[model samples]
Target chain A: MRSFVALFRKELRSYFGSPPFYFVATAFLAYAGYYFHSDLIYFITFGFGLNIMENFWQILFVDLRLVLIFAVPLLTMRLLAEERRLGTLELLLTYPLRDGAIVAAKLGACLVVVATLLAGTLVYPLLVYHVEPFAFEPLFAAYLGLLLFAGVCASYGLFISSLTDSQVLAGFLTALPLLLLWLLSWNEAAAASGTLPVVRAISLFNHFQPFSVGVIDLRDVFYFLYATGLFVWATLRVLEARQWRGRR
Target chain B: MIRSELLTKYYGSVRAVGGVSFSVGAGEVAALLGPNGAGKSTVMRLLTGYVSPTAGRALVGDVDVAERPVTARRQIGYLPEQVSLYPEFTVRRYLGFVGEVKGLARRRRRAAIGRVIEQCGLGEVADRHNGTLSKGYRQRVGLAQALLGDPAVLVLDEPTVGLDPVQAVEMRELIRTLAGCTVLLSTHNLTEASALCSRVIILSHGSLVAADTAAELGRRLEGAGRLVVRIDGPPDAVAQGLSALPGVLGIERGEPDGQAGVRFVVLASNPEPVQRRLAAMAVAAGWTLLEVQVKPPTLEDLFVRLVGSEP
Candidate 1:
């Protein structure tokens, strides 16, 4: 437990000690804030001031998904790649800690960065509540959806970071799979065909739609948890295989 | 406290470490001497559990490294070649992290960090970020990280590879202070091995060529000794007299030393006996013998003889 905490703190310090974390955070907030304001004003003038959560909340989440897809790669690219490139991974492996602890600490650090990036958007909801107090339950569900989505993306990005020592390659490979998953259900006609159940079951858009409408289905919650666990487990397996690959 | 039995490793088709076996008792300082690609680093990696051996076993203290790597690693403090470290971390924080990973308590981590910082001469750079440090300071920090938790065995590979003479000497002195633990380091510098290690293990082409103390290796590898003499006498007559002496295999005459003196290199099966004989013969011939010195073989000589001559 202590080693995990120590590793977590060290990774956190490294994330903030460099320029990349701040760069990604600033870009995420800039894009998210810009879209949030535009959508909110569009609802106020064009839709006669309906509940902000009903009109612009889902749009905010959709933009956040885009921000997450970009920001997650930046946050996770250096978790293992930088360590391997600098050759510190050898030293780290010699320490009296399990490989799982190292991976968990790094993943935890990435989630913390994602959380901080999401924290900046709390102002949008605060501004909504100040003008007209709306149903808070749906707002909570939407924020919950964004959190799970960020976590899932961060896990996949962490797995990709373990594959290479080049941060650029880790970022590119991480974004590629996420971009595909994000666009998996863009054609509704294709989604409503014979592959509807299978496509909807796997699509991030289908699972996240429930939370956007204030419906907390257990299946959707389980799907997010399942994806998070599967990727985290895959990351663990990759790290375990590294020892074999490292051997001569 | 450390042992390897028939240890071997192969990188695909290339053998990096052959069936090599050796052991270091508690509180012994040993050095692995070899050229590039000689499996020195591979052996260290095997013992540190950074890589598993292809065959045989490496034991740190009583635990086999491959069988229980985490348990065995708890007893070792390893500083790899080139001294890789996180460039963003300050020296203190880096060592603190290492201590924590080593399972030291919070209070103990603080104390260990302080002790290693003082022991490694890192007081000046304890708070400085690693990326901003000089090469020498970075090596010191690397050493400091390895010293945390006071493990029973220390494995250092080329601890002073790129430092200037002063820094190298200081680093060696720091290693010398670690006298109560089993210290095994691999280095290319013969003088460093002679200065810091009590035993030397020489490797060539991924196989153990020789292992012994520096003096013993010198004596065993050098079958014959050499002596240089400068005599103030007739050159031919001096050479003839030296040749007449017993145990002198051959004599080569060199340029005169002026004032009617000559220098001769006498190769003998035993230089000590030949040196005494030449001094006595010089006295009998009324030759003014300016110098008669035996050239003792060094570790460098043995290394060159073994590594340079290996095909």
Candidate 2:
């Protein structure tokens, strides 16, 4: 745990210290904020009912999802690849710490950075309160689902980052998998036929749709957790494999 | 405190390190000597838990490196050859992080970071971003990080490959100061090893050929010493001139050292005759002997001889 703290602080400090970390965080924050609030003032001045808040919440949820998908890869790309390229991974590995702690601390720190950006979007909700304070349940549900979805994305990005020393390669490979998951639900008719149950089950965005609609489905929650676990496990395996290859 | 028994590592079908076995007790410094790709760094990688051995095992303080890696790695500090760091981090935060990961308590962790920063001469740049430092400074940062937490074993690969002469000397002294700290530093710089390490391990093509004290390896590999005589006289004349002198085995002309000079070395089973030939050859041909010096068996000689003999 102490080791994890050390690693976590290093990760957080690294992000705050590097220009890229700030640049990426700021860029995503600006873009996602603007996408959700271009018409926020207009809606508020005219006075909206609960329905307006719901629509805003829905748009905000989508915006949150977009942030999770794109911003996470940027953050994770350098987590392992840059360390490997710089060869500091050797120095870090030699420390009296476990590989999981290293991975978790880094991954956790990035999630916090992303969460901070997501937290920045709270301004929109406060704006909604001027017209309607609205219900807490649905909004909280959507946010929770967004977090679950982001955890899965971040873990997958960390996995991709572990596989290569090139940040660009890690970023592109991570995006490739994410793009498929994001767009996978588009073929709903194919999923409906039941022939591609496995394919549909693998699509994260499809599972996320239940939460986006404000329904707390256990199956979807289970699926997201499972996806997160799968990627975390894969990342661990990849790190272990790297050692074997590096030794010989 | 550290030991390896027949540790071998393979990458797909390619073998990077094979059948290496060596041990270092606490307060001892073992130097791994080899040319590039000679598996010196690979061995460090295995012992430090950066990479796992494909076969056999590495034990650091009785903790099997692969099976209980986290526990084992906690006892080791590694300075990789690349000397890379988190460019944005200050030396303090970086080492603080490293100390934390090593499981030090907060107060002790801070103390350790401060000590290492001072020890590695990083005090001047403790707050500077790692990316902004010079190569020498970056290497110092790498060294500083490796020193964090003062683990039971320290594994450094080519730790001084890029420092200037003065800095290299300082680095050597620092490594020696760490004598009581169990250490394994690898380098192609034989002089560095002689000046710093107590034991030298020679690796050629991933195999351990000889491991001994610096002087012992030198004496065992090529024996006492010999001299290379490069002269302006004809090759045959130089050869004939030095031939049959007591303790002289023979003479052979080497490739041209320059257009005007024919270079040849004399192999004497003993050192005395080589010294005698230096004077005799200088007078015999008025040959403008460009360079005539007796060379002793050094770690470099041992490295070259062992590597040259590898099949």
Candidate 3:
């Protein structure tokens, strides 16, 4: 427990002290803010009879999730890759800490960063609330969904980071699979009607859609949590294998 | 305090360590002396629990590393050859992190950090960022991290590989001050091994070639004494004359003495007697004996002889 806290603190320091985190966070906010402002303008001008909660904030939440898919890879690319590249992983592994503790610490730090990034977008909800008060419960559910989705992305990104020492390669590889999973539901008409259900069922977009509508279905929550656990497990396995496969 | 029994590691088909075995008693300082690619780092890694052995056991304080790696690692302090540090972290912060990972209590962590800072002479640059520090300071910080928690065993790989002479000496001095700890360091430097370690474990091709004290290895490999003599005479006559001395096994012509004389290295069963006889013979034979000195065998000789004999 002590080792985990130490590693967690070190990893948090690395993220907060470095430029990449600030860069990714700033970029994500800027992108989300721009779209949120435009979406608000469109809602005010052409969104007559449209519900502010569903039409304004929910649309913004969906757009923010898209930005998260790209931002997470950038945030997690260096977690393990830079450690290996700098040869610090050997020292870290030799410490009196379990492999799972190390992985959990890194993943926890990245999740904190993800949460911070999502926190930056709270202003959009504030702006919507000022126009007309709405139910906070739905907004809370939407934010929860975004956080869960980001957690899954961060786990996969961290897993890929463990497999290579090149941050660029890790980032690219992580983005590729995430982008594919996000786009799986696209062009549904071209797919066989029978197989379309399976494709949508596995798609990250399909799972995240209910959260955008202020609905917290247990199935969607389970899907994100299960994916997060699976990738986190994969990362732990990779770390353990390094002891036998030899350091690259 | 540390033991390895037939410890072997293979990276796929390439064997990095092959059934090598050795032990360092409590409070003993030993050197893993080997050339590059001789598996010194691999052996250290195995012992430190950074990697598991393919076949065999590495024990620290009677705890098998493979069976209980984290428990065994708690008893070891390792300084890898490449002294890597988080560049963004200050020396103090990095050491604090290491102290925490070492499971030191908060108050104890502060004390240990301060102790190592003082012991390693890191007081001057304790606040400096690791990336901005000099190589010597970086190496010292590496040592400082290892010294945390005061583990029973210390595994240092090429501890002074990149430091200047002064820093190297300071590092060695700091290591020397580590009393009552089993220290096993690796180095290809013959002088360093002899200077810092009481026992030298010579490795060649991932196998233990010889393990003993430096002086003992030298004595065993010496077999016969050697003497270097400079004579102001014809090279051929000096060589032939030295061959005639009793107990002189052979004489090999050496480099010129830079002054009007020739040098010869005489191999003899008894060097002191041979030296006196050669000096007397030079005087009677009308050849000026400029210089004659007994030459003791060195660890370099032993290393070359042992490593060279390996295929």
What are the per-candidate TM-scores when only chain A is compared?
A: 0.92, 0.87, 0.95
RMSD of each: 6.5, 4.5, 4.8
Q: Interface RMSD computed for candidate 1 is what? A: 1.9
Which structure among the candidates has the greatest DockQ? 2
Using TM-score as the measure, what is the rank order of every candidate, best first? 3, 2, 1
- Give the per-residue lDDT of model 2 (tens digit) for A102-124: 78888899888877777877676
Q: B139 in model 1: Cα distance from truth in Å? A: 0.7
Give the C-alpha miss distance for residue B98 in model 1, angstroms.
2.1
Q: What ordering of candidates by DockQ runs from best to worst?
A: 2, 3, 1
Stretches > 4 Å off in candidate 3: A189-198, B215-219, B226-294, B309-311
Pairs with backbone N, CA or C atoms under 3 Å apart (clashes), candidate 3: none
Name the lDDT of candidate 2.
0.77
| Candidate number of the best TM-score | 3
Least accurate stretch of 10 residues (summed lDDT) in model 1 chain B?
Answer: B302-311
lDDT of 1 at B64: 97
Residues A1-248, model 1: lDDT tens digits: 88889999899888888787778878999999898888877887887566566677877787787778888888888888888799888888888777888888998988888888788998988888898777778877877888888788888888888888899999999988777667666665644477777877788777888787667888888899899889899988877664456521
